[model samples]
Target: MGGAVSAVAISSILIANRGEIACRIIRTARGLGLRTIAVYSEADRGAPHAVMADEAVMIGPAPVGESYLRSDRIIEAAQATRADAIHPGYGFLSENEAFAEAVDNAGLVFIGPPAKAIYLMGNKAEAKRRMLAAGVPCVPGYEGDDQDDLAFAEAAQDIGYPVMVKAAAGGGGRGMRLVDEAGELADALGLARSEAASAFGSDELILEKAVLRPRHVEIQVFADKHGNFIHLGERDCSVQRRHQKVIEEAPCPVMTEDLRAAMGSAAVDAAKAVDYRGAGTVEFLLDAAGDFYFLEMNTRLQVEHPVTEMITGLDLVAMQIAVAQGEELPLRQDDLKLNGHAIEARLYAEDPSRDYLPATGRIDLWRPAAGEGVRVDAGVATGMEVSPYYDPMLAKVIAWGETRDVARTRLVRALKESALLGPTTNSSFLVDILQRDAFIHGEATTAFLDEFYTGGFVADEPGGADVALAAALLLDDDRDAAFAAAGYVSATQLGWSSAPLSPIPLHLTTDRGVFDIGAECLGAVWSVTVGDDLFAVALGQRTDHAVRARINGRTIDAVAAISGSDIGLSVSGKCFRFHRARPGMEDDAAGSSGRVVAPMPGLVVDILVKKGQKVARGDALAVLEAMKMQHQIAAPIDGVVTGIDASKGDQLASGDLMIDIGDAAE
Candidate 1:
């Protein structure tokens, strides 16, 4: 039970984060009758969170290292805005002990776990030691001070192969690797260390036996100064990509009542281990034998906290704020209970088929799903630019239902009905997972995505006629009165022109590959054909980036937005980007275009080749860092480098020429 302890009065709170999480915290703070202050960089001047807050302050540039991660700037913003408390809404400095201390020293309440708790639990190795002492099961591995490469390799051999090399100081999926063989240990170690040092300012690593097909289940724990602690059930975040969770559901389907109680008790002990206050999470790897090992403790709110809230009918943020004010948790362990099933799908601006590389562009259309049991939390709006400076997650689509099946179905429907254009997303991939039998049967594990769907998730391509129709609508004068008028004409009478018009030939490239479409407009009707398929379309009035049309006697609703030289089309929540390729401009299979271009906006972190250097196909030519991840831009073919246009630290836009690689001599 919590006790009445000294508490600081708070009226206004400053959120030291951006995007959806900032908007989430502000909503809760407003509900609690508190003014919310938001901080943003130049890139987020018009972001939803900044505009939604009671007041906003510009901190620094777009780069997070110079902006959101700058604790001093965040504190200054809070003080200048006359805020009483600061909520570091996950990521950035949310789990940084120094940031917590800074907030406390600035005479403001840190709406999270205490600074000492964060410090003690932040280091994965030390936290494992603490968990072991507290009788919490830990994965078999080494967390010793001797992090010598040789010693680590030996420890991996001792713990056995397929051990996970992880940065002790970092969260998310960063600074982590799974070494399946002895041969892979060295590379995994070096890369993990480098990523750790870069991300968390510490290269210290810990190795653990990679639990095969384990379930990633975390308990939401809340504590108060009065010494009260409670676990709000468990969330199975087993569906992941690149070590980051993509889907999370509360009241894990596989969890029995006894298992839930056992895990909940362990989580409570974990919170008590650090004397944690406010909200935190105790993550564990649940094995097939029903045994669970402590993975790590997140000393802040989690990105998937909404699912927990949906199932428990609790506002975790509000509870966090109250606990920060020294108020005891209203519910005890016995009083807390789970209700309806809840699931959350994280929509990210990344291509699932391309190793999850991030995408950046303006959101031409953003219409979240709407209906009962559906809740969409997003910080983006139509025309908002999705930059390379932050996480690629655009929003969280959460659904709740009376049963797990009901919830799963609702979530799948919501994902299919939600619309986003411009940047590619994993919406379709999420729907695929929800529909998979492995997931529906509640049998998915940490290896579910890789093991079951090895080919990667791909959305179904629209019909050839549909594709041709979309292209024709985009190229046609959408505002033409004749087009709107023809939409109302009888289908039988449509396309009956006394004088036939010349067919408009268009070259198009889409996710489904390239096609040559021909269109002949007859008043409001258009004859669209792609290859052998022909489609008669009645074009309706256009609205902003969307259009209403009837194709082959069937009405179709779609969004058509112009993005650069490409056209983006969205129908039934699936989006496709098509480049209008000129007939003579298409590159041959040999990539004779003779140019190596940046695939997306990013910072050139490394130039692997110099001018005049010879390279082969698939050779790493350079490394570009974007969305806090590194991507290798490889050579398209065997060629000799003729020019280098970018250097380390150079910011590049999508299509910016990186280097010129002329064809190699025979």
Candidate 2:
């Protein structure tokens, strides 16, 4: 396909993906004067990527298996759109060898590596074998065909304690588990196999020695069908949670020139060994001693590709299109140079305080940060619903600077400046990580979160000042509504009273608890009291999406979204959601009420308890699968199961009752 005769002129391209990556690809394709087609599920009909594309096609339902993962539907959509090529952005079908081959059979260019390369690297076991044959350093492990439990037990014993059981076809941490001892091997294997089958359609298992505290560094390599390959540099993706990267940065802080050259050479060799084309990442586990071992090769652009693009000053997507068009290398290795440092933070719609449980709700407000060296790759907007049918990642915040410190500071500030409310997010948690000394000094390793946040991250309680601000905002909204209802009456006469009006007592409920607040509106200013403290707030320059307010002589610009009685406010890089409490309308204590509820909307995969069964506190009661991950619902208290409201294969919404537990005595 490299020769001139095989060159396929491409004028239109279809993106078989969704969210920010799809939008990102469209931007580059549009810049290159190519018509862009987007395919979406029913849940994404109004999504940003679908709206931004030159043309859009509805593929199927919301479930990935019925939509994004349907190779036939994707190819049909491409043919219907008459697109010259299809770009499978990361995740779904990006690394699927069969999908790539299917695209080729359809006579449409697949804007990625050849199907053979994808097949060779898609399976961890096969990839390790090939890398070993290529003389690449790999971790000591077992990749034999024997899938028996006894075989895994023996392999773990030989590999010593703390072995990693991984899915052969897994990415994004699915179907992976760490076994610290032989005792936990079976359970780990079972869970891993289930997740692997659900996520990648493969339950093939492999064993590897757990590289304790190694930094996850990967080289970004690009190649053309003409056999030219070069490495851009390395990205340090050491800070992670649940084995998924949370933060990534270019020019690994601990990297040396010699080490970069060594790793780069190895990565290029890995690419050449497979005759890989377009963009790929060769991940490695770098020890403190600077020794690195081959991890695996990702055959598509990574979620963190923005970090590389920021430092390289080149569009990797554009390069991928060029390679798909049978173009030669744009530049040689010697001409390539890494410019400033860049860092990326993924913004996910999840609750860090709740073990990072994926959240689904309407996005009440979305105001991405904008400034020098800051870029936001997002696919969400105000009033949009974050569906539970896809990944929880909502956006990516990346910053570039001349130095690592500069980039770190800018990213922290940018994360704070940007606002996303309604659904719980990890924004504040990300800020805390940026401020951690371990991360700032560049000493973070794979165990960074495990060592630092042993009990998981618990956000600080909203302070009195924030509560006062919420009360003031709610009062201001009420005043504005009153004015608008009065047929555009003058603001000065709207709230004017002949006598002193008693402060309106309100109760605002937050995750911390219910707060009793009193707000008194006096002309343009407000006197809000939370507990014993009082705040004089004067709001200035209010808009639909933001407001400038002075609280006790300190002026602050905050993004605000008010919907009915619910209020979302962001100020000084902190976000707070407040629900106006009414009489006898407080939330029920679910645990004390003996109600076992689903934490989020998902399908019930398994029910571990039966009616009349006695269970202790913290016992696993059921498992709910959502967004490609399994979350166990645990018994909140010791009780007898009086009723089972949900059955296996049932789709449940957030807070839907799954089981009813009665007192143990019953």
Candidate 3:
């Protein structure tokens, strides 16, 4: 190890990001007795991260190009607050070489690797070249600088079919396309270029052979300015959807001691090749035969770093700060030991049934899970609005235990207990993945979702018991309100009539269908009937947002959020939404309107069809960009385009009409 250099004193740090990552960095900085400053876009003015910071500065508007990505504004915020350092936490300018250099030029400590290292590793094409020179095994593909379409086509033919078109300057599944044959190469290249330019401000492309069904394992490597480097085991991120990681666990189940040593040493060599500093992750594609090839190096801390921290008992953010202050690493490779297994699942505000389309709305209820060995890193709260301007990830739930099975069980229970209402979420889907036989046996590959859920995930409809519970809860709430209005001393006097009370009737609507439910209050218990099924529900502990009740002698805990006529409830790790059907409110011709509407809030990237153009069912109509992903809107029926209400570059809200289709004869 090299001798210690002059230490850079840092008293305050301005976090140059938002959401859970910003909150995560602020917490560590605060624990280390450092003042934290947060910069936010107008859309995130009162977000959790902004509220948690000692001081907040409004950087710019909601669009990242106008706000978080503006390095000058972030530096200005830090200087204005008299902060000594800037922590670009995980996204936005975190891996931007120019931003890192700008911070250094401004005399502020950048709590990450040097600008030179970022430049060398930020681009996938160049990073592959460097890794190859350093004797690191790499996937066989093309990373040449020829920007011609013909060049890429020829390269694809040379590399064989089923290749990946990747953005040279970024990751996170954006600007990446999988091509199955030569016929799909052109469109893949065009779409990948468009996304790459939009997301990373670069249209440079790289081609890699699609390593089929490989496990995505990455090594968490840390280095200090004193030249000491060590890697904290590996994380298996094979469970994915749309090329993005959904679940991550430490100590990849398939890893052997020899394989670990080889991969870890390769990761350290890659870090040393770039003179890397602070936190970084070297990703690899490990095949079934135990051969691992270098994928790329993320020059900044990864989003799934928490699992490694849990198993290794280390605080990576603290290590980054210490390295930024010119401190030597506290431990060596031999000193590190993995104590247990840990798994983390990302909680996103999205609808899996709708092709994972991002959802936007107010978070009416937010209750993260709490238990021994469970950790929740969340950046949302009740009443906060989830805007379309940023990522849909709301939080990360992690659990650690003495074994992988214990960790998996704890994580499943925690997800089931957590409650998030208003916008649809993938919490239920996450629970399903954790309980899968393949996952439980640690035999999952990157193609797990493709092989199992080829038709996409469709959530199960609410059962009779669930519907009855919702109806009963509504009835009880109404009774309590009425009793208070009548100046009753206590709500317990609601059903104390000397004679038997009549049953109350309600019609509740869900996506499955409408149900006519009858509920009667019989002393302390409710007799709820849905169709022919009857349930005896006895109320227990109750709160404004949650209730514990025994249904048919089986105790169940549930949380609910009431907004007007809609009720959002969570039970058994699944979410059910019910709407109290009002007379004269049902539309007779809702689905046959022949109108195409935006499924979620997004910006129109392209309008493929124009007025008077005939279209067949499933014909491409338009392309929408929402939450950094592209969604293709297709024609619902065979008809002529009668009218167009949205244009390219238009920002649309959910359910906004985008096109009109009339009968082919018309």
Candidate 4:
């Protein structure tokens, strides 16, 4: 080690990030008896991490460019706080070599790899060349430093169709595009370059042969300045959406003992080539032929590091801090062992049904799953606002078990039971993914989401009785009395209706469409019927925000949040939003008048159509940039564009009118 020959010490650490990862690093730092400092943007002032830290500092505005990405400000914060070290939690400037060098220059420890190592591995082209020199097999593609677009096009042709155009300076599916055919190469190149410049400040591109339907496997490698290195097996991140990993699991289900050893050795070699230290991941593409190709090296902690930690019983953050303190490797390669299977699902504040567009709103009800083998690392709490200024990921739900099936089962159950209201989330879709036969059978590929879940996985809709129960809960005058009266009563005296009173008619609208139902008390019970299905409900107990109710002789748990005429409810692991119908609400005037609005709050990136343009339903009208991703706003109906109210570069709020369309005939 570089410092004392025996042991070094760190008194305080400033975490240069926000959200769950920041909280994660703080917890480990606290456990090690080190004072933790937290840095936040204006939007994250009230975030959970800020509250958990011993000292908190405001960096700048909500945008990352003004805050988290400001390395000089972060280092200044560390210096002002008298922090001995800085821990960059995965994102922001975690992989920036300049930031590491700045911290070092400021006499502060950078709790990650050396600046030289980061610089060597941060450039995708240079990293691939180093990996190849180290005898690691890389994906077949061109990583030349040529700036010519025609050169890239020619390189793609040689690499074959279905190539991945990626920004050489960054990862996380940003500035990355998958070109499937020769004709789509130009547009893909243009968009990828634009996004790369915007996100990573780099327009350099690299072409890789897209490993068709391959599983994304990555090895967690830890090294020390003492020249000691060890691999913590591998994680399978095959389940993805929009080229980003959605779910990750350790001890990849299909990995045999021999294969694991081979990949682990290669990962160690890759790490050693750059003289890496701290926590890093070497990603690979495992093909169906049982062969693997190096993808890239992440020179900092990974988003999926929790899965590796769970399976190996190690705190990666603690390890990173220790390595920074000039401590030797805590455990040798032979001393470590993988004990169990672990799976982690990322909980995002986004609506999967709407092309996974990011969502922003207050979290009214936050009930996370709690039980054996289930762990939730969440960033937001009840009444917290999920802003659109940052990434939409709110938490990571990790489950551990002795077997892959057991881990999968626990993760599914945990996801179903966890309830997050107000902003839309992907909790339900994660459960559906866990239940997929391909995933359960350990055959899922990187193309799994595109192949089977392209239309978005729809969770089971609530039954009529569930809706009735929800409405009753939302409209209930006495929660205590309703729970107190926990038995079946005669319909005539159920109190919902009496004498000449008629049953209430309700029109419930949700993302799945509208549901119309009539609810009333029958002769012997409070019954609800939809189409041909009938149900009887009895309220049992109200605990916290959840209600244990018996519906048709089966007991189930549910939670609800009421806001004016809308009710957001969770039943049997499914999330639903029901808006009570108002008089004449079915025929909305603005919608009928052909006024199409922006579906969310975002920056208008591109306007695809102009005034007087004819378009069909589902035709692209404009593109909006939100939550660091782009979403296409499409036409809701086939009509002529009579007016374009919004222009490029305009910042829009949700439901802001964007276009007006007038048609000839319906």
Q: What do the candidate models score in CA lDDT, each in turn? A: 0.87, 0.91, 0.91, 0.84
Which residue runs of candidate 2 sit more than 4 Å off their true CA positions? 1-5, 488-501, 587-590
Q: Per-residue CA lDDT of candidate 3, range 205-280, in tens?
A: 9999999999999999999988899999999999998889999999899999999999999999999999999999
**Shift in Å, residue 352, candidate 1:** 1.1
Clashes of each: 2, 0, 0, 1
Given candidate 3, what's the lDDT at residue 586? 52
Q: Cα RMSDs of all predictions?
A: 3.2, 1.8, 1.9, 3.7
Candidate with best TM-score: 2
Task: Write down the TM-score of every candidate.
Answer: 0.93, 0.97, 0.96, 0.92
Quote the lDDT for 489 in model 1. Answer: 42
How accurate locally is residue 17 in candidate 2, as Cα lDDT from 0 to 100?
98
Per-residue lDDT for 145 in model 4? Answer: 76
- lDDT score for residue 287 of model 4: 95
lDDT of 2 at 428: 93
Error of 3 at 431 (Å): 0.9
Residue pairs with clashing backbones, model 3: none
lDDT of 1 by residue, 1-666 (tens): 444588667899999999999999999899889999999999999999999999999999999988999999999999999999999999899989999999999999999988899988999988999999898888888999998999998998899988999999978998899999999889788778866776788999999999999999999999888878889999999999879999999989899999999998999898898888989999999999899999999999999999999989999999999888877898998898789899999999998877787988888888888999999999999989999999899999999999999999999889987888888998888988898999999998999999977887655676775586677665564323344586654322343444445778878887546778888877667788888888888877677766778888888888787765677787776778888888745534324466888888998978989988999888988988888777888888788999999999899999899989887773
